[model samples]
Target: QGLRRAAKVQAGQKVLVIGAGGGVGTFAVQLAKAFGADVTGVCSTKKTDLVRSIGADDVIDYTREDFADRPRRYDLILDIAGGRSLSHLRRALDPRGTLVIVGSERGGRWAQGVDRALRAAMLSPFVSQKLRMLVSTENEEDLQLLGKLIEGGKITPVVDRTFSLSEVPEAIEYLRGGHACGKVVITE
Candidate 1:
């Protein structure tokens, strides 16, 4: 819902989800589809099938080609696995599109994507496109809404692996290695 709310997604819109095979990405794709948008998922070659199976109308393999270089332009772009710069992302976004930066895996110790988000906010007023960052809010209403969506089969959580209490370290290592297909759960 964060992606949908941030992007103000409307039916029949063109939506692109970066890092569409990961935990958040998977949900984003499904939610976009539920909103009746034409959804495109971006991921590496190995995860393309997973993204496609989850309801992405189109799947772009980042390793093989950059979506920004393509002829397509999205009405809404959700940058969940942020590695691209604002300019790079803008290239793929429609002139009046909205870009929502959700998270970034790359950055210095001080701040990850926070810096980029700030810059986007500062620059938004000067540009035709809208660029903003998403800070998720937890509330009972939203939780219940998501629950309904899950119950209705509009969204499903993807758990790639689960580790017991003793295997926490190994689980962290696996996450750091970036090999997990989806969410990694730690069980007590």
Candidate 2:
């Protein structure tokens, strides 16, 4: 909600999601659509259909193409995967665009999310785009909205695979392989 609020997602703005098939990215896509923005999702070739199924107006197969390199610019970017460097992501955005960096893979051992947020802040003053990190606090009202969307069939959680409690090792391996179509949930 912070990103959507800060960017002021309007009825016709263009939003880009870098990892549309993942957990947070999936929510980002739906929320953007619900907020009335035209959303474009970027995921691997294997997740293209999954991204499209969630109401993204466009899905870019990152395995085959760099959506960021395209001539099209976005008004807001919810970068769920910090795969691209700061400068590269900025290139895909409009001069006054907002970049919401929400990935934590780079900071290996400690305070992963914090490190990314700090880096974004450090690079902010020198750039034209409003680069920042997102931190969502789920409240009752928003959860109610999310619940309504799920119950109403406007949004659905994509479960890539379900694993028994004893098979957690295998589930971890599956996620590490990077081919899981959606969320790998472990149920008792």
Candidate 3:
């Protein structure tokens, strides 16, 4: 819902989601599809099937190809796996497209992904495309809306693995390894 709300996605818009096999990316793909957009998911080769199964019109294996080099441009691009430069991402966006940076996985402790997001904000006004960052906010209204969508069969949560409370450390290690296919859950 955050991505949808931030991007203001519309019907028939071509949307691209990076890290589509991960937790947030998976939800973004389903939400965009539910919103009636033509969705494309980008992930590593091993996770292509998972992304496609979740309703992506197309899937790009980042390990096999660079989505930026593709001729096609998206009306909206969601960057959740933030390793690429802002300039590289802009190349894949339509001139008037909107790019929402959902998360960043780069840099050291001081700035990390925040630096790239800041750069995007600084550069946005000078460019034709809309570049912005998303900090997800939880509220009852949005939760109710998401629940309705889930009940209506428009969206479904994807849980890749579950761990006991005692396994929290291991769970974090697993996530840091980047092998999980979807959302990780911790249960008591």
The best candidate in terms of lDDT: 3
> Which segments of candidate 3 are over 4 A away from where they belong?
108-110
Maximum-TM-score candidate: 3
Question: TM-score of each candidate?
Answer: 0.94, 0.88, 0.95
Between which residue pairs do clashes occur in model 1?
none
lDDT of 3 by residue, 126-159 (tens): 9999999887888998899889999999988999
Candidate 3 Cα deviation (angstroms), residue 186 = 1.0
Candidate 2 global TM-score = 0.88
Better of 1 and 2 by lDDT: 1
Candidate 1 segments exceeding 4 Å error = 109-112
**If the candidates were sorted by their lDDT against the true structure, best first, what order would they fall in?**
3, 1, 2
List, residue by residue over 9-82, the lDDT tens digit for candidate 2.
78788999888898777888888888789999999887888899889999999889888679999999888777
What lDDT is obtained when candidate 3 is compared to the true structure?
A: 0.90
CA lDDT for candidate 1: 0.87
Score candidate 1 by TM-score against the native. Answer: 0.94
C-alpha positional error of residue 101 in candidate 1 after TM-score superposition, expressed in Å: 0.4
Q: What is the C-alpha RMSD of each candidate to the true structure, in Å?
A: 1.5, 2.3, 1.4
Candidate 2: regions farther than 4 A off:
107-116
On residues 1-188, what C-alpha lDDT tens digit does candidate 1 reach at each position? 55557778999999999989888898889989988999999998888988888899999999999999999999999998877889999999999999998865566455764888878888999999999888888778878877898999998888999999999999999988775777999999
Worst 10 residues of 2 by lDDT: 105-114
